[model samples]
Target chain A: MTAPEPAYVAVDWGTSSFRLWLIGRDGDVLAERRSGEGMTTAARTGFAEVLESHLAAVSAPAGLPVLICGMAGAKQGWVEAGYLDTPAALADIPAAAVRIPGAAADIRILPGLAQRDAAAPDVMRGEETQLLGAAAQLGEGDHLVCMPGTHSKWVRLSGGKVAGFSTFMTGELFEAIARNTILSHAIAEAGPISGDNAAFRTAVTRMVANPALATSQLFSVRAGSLIAGLSPVDAKARLSGTLIGLEIAGALSLVAEGTPVALVVSGGLGTLYKDALAAAGISPAVIDADAAVRNGLAAGARALWSL
Target chain B: MTAPEPAYVAVDWGTSSFRLWLIGRDGDVLAERRSGEGMTTAARTGFAEVLESHLAAVSAPAGLPVLICGMAGAKQGWVEAGYLDTPAALADIPAAAVRIPGAAADIRILPGLAQRDAAAPDVMRGEETQLLGAAAQLGEGDHLVCMPGTHSKWVRLSGGKVAGFSTFMTGELFEAIARNTILSHAIAEAGPISGDNAAFRTAVTRMVANPALATSQLFSVRAGSLIAGLSPVDAKARLSGTLIGLEIAGALSLVAEGTPVALVVSGGLGTLYKDALAAAGISPAVIDADAAVRNGLAAGARALWSL
Candidate 1:
């Protein structure tokens, strides 16, 4: 078997990092490339050059169709692919792909999802593609999808249509609070927090019990370390847990009671969020976020070029 | 009708500020001096020298005993005054003042307050003195006192005894999030938020309604600006309002409903907290924090040296 002929290239280009996967006709990942050349860098160095250089390294065939997702489709990115307003159908995302004007290949960027509610206006870029792929496994009925990241997005999906979602500034807030605030002295190294940590689970439990005391609980990190000699690791864990717990509590509030939930995540944060959810009495159906995005790009490719 | 003779010198030396007041025999402020020579600065410039220069400028009588509070008493301050454990009487705080050794003048610094519960161990330095003076005016009964600052402190005063207190990282979190997170783009300049702003009151109301949605609401500040044309002023207001409202919610949760609350703030944050509290449906009696600390210092001086 001569390694199945290459079909297309799928890219998840985020703010500060770029990832591209070459796919075979059988939907297998033929070759892959990862880089720090995200939108911020590509916008300066030229998006077309960045993409072509990666493609050349992977030895892609000339003029092969490429499906792009994430910030690369932003107004400031390679080519503007505006947002598809909710409640948008996941299947229709590919048809809305914005094609590059003068690119050599059939390069198209996927549109993001925008919730235009007057009260809670929100937006998402690459996560739309991830959700589109993840939604394939999540068939029928309603589901609360958790896509944890720097800004954790909780989406409400109904029958393959995007209803609405909320973005929680949990991870970003955790980092800022840990680095810039007085709590910096408590959690010294500012290391990665563990899910199995008792302080982590306890923080989640406390937030679920009374989410109002969040900032106060944050103060407890400093105070606990000062008065109670709380270990640095526990301090970091509690800090991480408080933000994650608050995120879960806020997300759960928007959904109907007992709505099936799916956690689409990959790596360490996956475990951290899982522990936080368990601490909040939630056991989510897990999906690999990495695979979800790849599958999403594949779906887009299949629609755009019938590859 | 001759000029009043100076009796004692009162100082409220905080982390980043230095304030000195010359008090007459009749409890009048004869002369005042303020500088940036707080604990963080005084430690390098010599706390004794910093105090003496201000005292000499005010022509404070030689050997006139000095009453100091705030970070001047921290271990990292001029000299560690330590902390008075909870259930401590406000009247008893004066007796615990730690004397500054090897000083030309008879100088003393007051002790701070510490809540040592296992789950919620907390500490406070300068605010304890403010609480001491504020308690005198409160005159018995349980009062939830709000002292808004970089770290807002809510003291539970019960019958003139320091019951317990909580410190919220509200003000600090607001600054950090506004400057460090992605929301910074939404709230340009991050100017001081107004209490009278509609967005501010709305944010406070929302937090009071569902404190769980804090981080999500924070994201709304950015999304609101991105999709809904939310103004920078309104964006900043929402950010400030969200943190302040969460603080009020947390403080209220720790107390019995309808506890007589008092706002002990000095500057702009006073109006902000008042508006936020009103939005939360509570009208707290107000106290000027600057005066509270001065009054606390006077009380300490009278108790210490019968001035």
Candidate 2:
């Protein structure tokens, strides 16, 4: 494949992951690099070095403006790009990007979104970019966008404005409970839980029906393994379903009925969440997270440098 | 504390704790022994040896019938005492106790309670004894009993029969989530969560109102700490409240409206749960767990040996 001359560099630097794409003037990907040197690793290894290595690996031209997002903007990251408090507008995000001073290349890290309400103080670093990229597909009107990951974000978007959002530690809690609690014994050797698993669907439905019974349902995983002869795979699936189902139910509780839902996700988690949402009787418009973040970075570039 | 002549020996052999009580024929305490040589330790250091040492410590009469409960009856314990299926009679439990064979002493372990339904399979070993002891205080009629611990059991008792029970992994989940997840950073050096904390009460109220939003509430603890100037104590309290509140909500859902609730708890957890129950709008009849287990063993002995 012949590589097009890179117009600019787009980076999505998350907590534990880093992805960079060289974009052509025509909006086509010229070259790409992905690594585990995200904000956490980059903070220790020097963020500039990590970015420069990835840029060099992609053979990007000198003076190409690099636009970044995610934890790179976190306080402990390369630069504290800070946050744009909610009810902030998406169009105003690029202008808020904090440039890395004294750097050889033109590099800018986009600020995150923060809801500073006393009741639900929340912050999201890299996902604002994804929301920006996927915002066009989501269109106008009321939207409840579900972004599933370590800390899942359920954002309320009206028109082009991010009204507010809630973060659920669904993925992180699942890992902690499964690995550190008695349920670990039940699912220790199990493989990845499939979205199509019957146990998975049932658990999701149950949580949505009576979310108060969530922790009790978690114990039932171990009990089921002991008395009901639940296999390790099914046990694992139940754990996954309960957490994901709780997330869906929580998100649903905040929004108005019949509001359009969009899921910005990639890979296996995408399928799992899709199935979970389906179990909860909602079909969301799906957006590939990879393209969304890249598109978000490109949007930032276009606004910042007219690329 | 005048010591009476030993009529029989009662033992609560739990997972990580061992307690032995010498009871008089008139139901008076004779001598007592407690140790960490519970089923787990005894299973390794020899169950017979552990029992013999405790018996020696109490100076029990040789061949005195010993009544045991909890994990000592599990398959991995000294003897497999099995389980009494629900809706089981409290009177029938003593009859099902498995006597340890080939021992100089007549030692019997009480059977646990099991609900083997496909939907909510559950089991309880030690807490069944607590329920048995607390049943008299609970009196006749429908009762919902909350026994908070490592595996918190919510029992549904109709008259002297146990209809069913559900276990919530509240304590275990709290430890796992606090120590194994990102929230650890928020509550790294925090003290134990108290029932009196406003944060605790507020969390309980929130969960009761909308249990589906439970996991989201968990993330708020971390978010609150990071952005809302939440102290470590409040962070810990919030985490504790979320789990406990979820348990309360789950327990309430299973019982009839306004069923008289009883709390069978012993230590600090008792106070925390009492506050949680109060927050959920229920004033439970509190029963000291220590006395309840001993009474259970005494009741079992009376039924078995007519002591």
Candidate 3:
């Protein structure tokens, strides 16, 4: 008879989104599900109700093991898994087995990572696991890994551990500046990441070469369009280029110069970075973040089972 | 007769704040008043009521001329002062007087500036006046004027006109990053802006040198505090330095490199720019923004009478 289906589920839950995978005994994903029951909205409907609703569709056995990551393990998550400070390895991740009273599954939440800098102590959730997963795949190399999102992370990986990392509110900054600030009207809703967009490249180079000018440069996007008749689409692209390019230049400085760095980009803006990296004379190894998270969850699950 | 009284009551209204001055024919300040009658909140109480209530304390003639600046002249103001496109001189500023019915005054609002770039068209409101003020002061010089505020403006003054200018959402960016984003807790309420904080200067220089890394470097503030025991105030200062220093570097680029440039800083953060300017090896000719605005109003008023 087929071995009783694996008794565990792995989940990657974040602020505004959630993803889950049903695993069999041998680490096979029997079924996968995604939903809007993210940490932010999970409060309106209780976390248990949200989880039960999503799990109802899955065919996992009663009383299965469920492991979760991301914001779902934060202070406000289904269960708080506390933070594990950095200089951490895979084994350093904390495992908290949370039993949902009268539920069919026992949930284990993974703790996020924290790192102390004598200059500015910092901590992070969710991305630490992704970083761990990426480091595991990369083996050993002095590299700069840029994970672009609402709050982008730039991590330096060396000697099989996270040497140091920094976070930029690049995505959030972009949104606020584009939507909430005065430049909102001049930018288009959407446009090609790269095209006959010389403004984009010029902006990127300008910021990268002279980051100090980033604040003032933003004004030029609107001025160039309004005064010189710059197309709104091109203006938007230029604005994006300026912010992203500045981020790339900033990220590059975290590691040793000429260290043969590889930008392990993971996020929606990964393609943009690939283009930007190319323009800046750097070739990056692009990794699908969703796939990487799945791989990480699987690897994490396997490690939990000591397989 | 008492210098013919003031022809008009000039107002400078802004988001979250408002200020008005009673001016005489000779540009003497008859009286001035300010209130929390900011634009954001004024919507709840009609703009007319706000104006009436604030001016209730001042005794101006019913038919006096009223000139206004700032957000009071925006499209959303009591009456919109349409934008004047750029390559515009002080004389070109549109004077489409806004008439507020049922008021004891003749309101003439000065129009803001708009500029179109063939690639990215944009516009400005109060900043145009600030630029005009800077230009008026410089008289004749190739000047790089840095105006720091919620939205920082770097104007190029050439041939006694606004050659071109750029704006950076640096202050807003800092507020959003520090108060709205994950870095909120990492920063303190306030910090020293003096040279005693070398770490602050270092972080600034680092960011100016490589702006792309801004996102990642933010995490270091937390890490430094948690691991190395950095004081919260110092951490906050470092973050501020990084942002401002980045802006100063960007503002510097509006002029030819190594050119004799004068940085005319007008804002609440003039002292902060003073420190940043010193660090960057530039001399700063600081001006009280309020004083400059008054001077600008006088110039505009004088020009209007002459016309």
DockQ of each model against the real complex?
0.86, 0.86, 0.45
Alpha-carbon deviation at B18 in model 2, angstroms:
0.3
lDDT of 2 by residue, B1-307 (tens): 8656789999999999999998887888888888899888989899999999888888888999999999999988999989999999888888899989998888899999989987788999988888888888889999999999889999999989999999999989988988999889999899877899999999998888888888888888888887899999999999999899999888899988989999999988899999998888999999999999999888888888887
lDDT of 3: 0.69
Task: Give the alpha carbon lDDT tens digit for every residue of A152-259 in model 1.
Answer: 999999999989999999989988998899999999975677899999999999999899999999999999998898999999999998999988888999989999
Residue pairs in candidate 2 whose N, alpha carbon or C atoms collide under 3 angstroms: A70-A126
- State the weakest 10-residue window (summed lDDT) of model 2 chain B: B1-10
| lDDT by residue (tens digit), candidate 3, A1-307 | 8664764787888999888888777667788899888999997788877777667788666667777789887777777776666666554563433434565555777777666555335566777667656666677867777787777777777776677667776777777778756677778665655623677777777766776666667777756755566677777878788877778777776667765545555544676777776666687776667766766666666666554
Best by DockQ: 1
Candidate 1 chain A weakest lDDT stretch, 10 residues = A185-194
Better of 1 and 3 by TM-score: 1
The ten-residue window of minimal lDDT in model 3 chain B covers B114-123
Candidate 2: stretches off by over 4 Å: A1-4, B1-3
**Model 1 chain B: lowest-lDDT 10 consecutive positions:** B186-195
Error of 1 at B194 (Å): 1.8
